[model samples]
Target: MIKIETPLTIDKVKCLKAGDEVLITGTMYTLRDAGHMRVIEQINKDEKLPFDMKNSIIYYVGPSPAKLGAVIGSAGPTTSYRMDEFTPALLELGLKGMIGKGARNKEVIQSMVKNTAVYFGAVGGAAALLASCIKSSEIIAYEDLGPEALRKLYVEDFPVIVVIDSLGKNIYEIEKEKYKIVE
Candidate 1:
């Protein structure tokens, strides 16, 4: 497995390819649909985002309320397709990577290639296991959105698969083709 660090640089992302297994370490931001909308609004108003976008990664999740003495609750990836509407905009702002489950739309995939970005697939239904990788997390913006708020997270050895690479190559497409039953 390739070990990657946060604030991923263009060179680093370029080296990654679809179908590689990777472990990401360092900080990543969290945003659900509400937070995503806010990002677009912030950009339209020329307002600075809650976190710097350059070379940053965002994880799509709305973690459950933490239990006492826990840093986070069951934290799993949300479906990536839901974020497709705002993904191109985020990528244009130098967002280097994203972590979520499922396939993205064509426009979003094209944007990744144009922006030298990558998309990672976190295993679905692995919430409790994945939550352990989060060392710390805090609300960074849109707290009123509750679980849909934007958050800053410090993670270590977070496991993910390269679903889409900077070249617009896609693991989803490859796997689908491989499994196709030729009649």
Candidate 2:
């Protein structure tokens, strides 16, 4: 497995390839659908964002409330497609990477290529394991959204796979082709 850290620069993003396992260590933002919408709204209104987008990675998760003594709970990745419509705009604004589960749409892939970004896939069934990697979590914005509120997370060795590389190589498409049944 490859080891990577954030804030991810174009150099770091370009070095990754689809299908490579990675253990990421550093800061990442957590936001679900409602938080994404709120961010877009802020951008449209020309308001400053709560965090810097440049060279940053956002994780798509709405973690469950922590049971006393835990940093976060059940922090599994959410389906990425739900955020596809908002992704290109964020990519345009220098967002460099995203961690989630499932395939993204064509437009999202195209945007990643255009902006030199990457998409990582976190295992879906390993919520507790993922939460263990989070060293700290602080709500950053949209607190009214509760679990969907934006959070800044400090992580260490958070596991993921490069689902889509900056050059547009996609593991989902590659794997499908690799195992396709001959007609």
Candidate 3:
């Protein structure tokens, strides 16, 4: 398994391809739909963002409240398409990677190519299992959003697969074409 560091660089992100299995280390941030909307709204207003966008990785999740003595609880990815409207702006702002489940829209995928970004797919319905990988969590912004608040997370070897690479290659599209039946 290829291990990647946080705050990914352009070269580091470009090295990855569609279908690569990766274990990410260091820090990442969480942003569900509400968090995304806030960030995008800030961008639209030309206001400062809550965090730096350069080489950033945003995981689409809204973790349940932490259980007693746990750092976080039942954290898993949400449907990525819901955040597509805000994705291109983030990518344009230098976001190098994203972690979530499901396919992205064509505009987002095309933006990934233009911006040299990648989308990683985490296993859906694996919230309980994935929580173990997040070592720590802290509310970073928009605390009023509750479960959808932005969070800074330090992760260790968090598992994900490259569903869409910087070059615009996509596993979903490739698999569909590969399995298409000839009439």
Q: Per model, how many backbone clashes are there?
A: 0, 0, 0
TM-scores of the candidates are 0.97, 0.97, 0.96
**Which candidate comes out best when scored by lDDT?**
2
Candidate order by decreasing TM-score = 2, 1, 3
* Cα error of candidate 3 at position 101, Å: 0.9
- What would the per-residue lDDT of candidate 2 be over residues 97-161, giving only the tens digit for each residue? 99999989999999999999999999997999999999999998999999999999999999999
RMSD of each: 0.9, 0.9, 1.3
lDDT tens readout by residue for model 3, 107-176 = 9999999999999999998998899999999998999999999999999999999999999999888988
Model 1 misses residue 10 by how many Å? 0.6
* TM-score, cand. 1: 0.97
Clashes of 3: 0
True lDDT of residue 163, candidate 1: 92
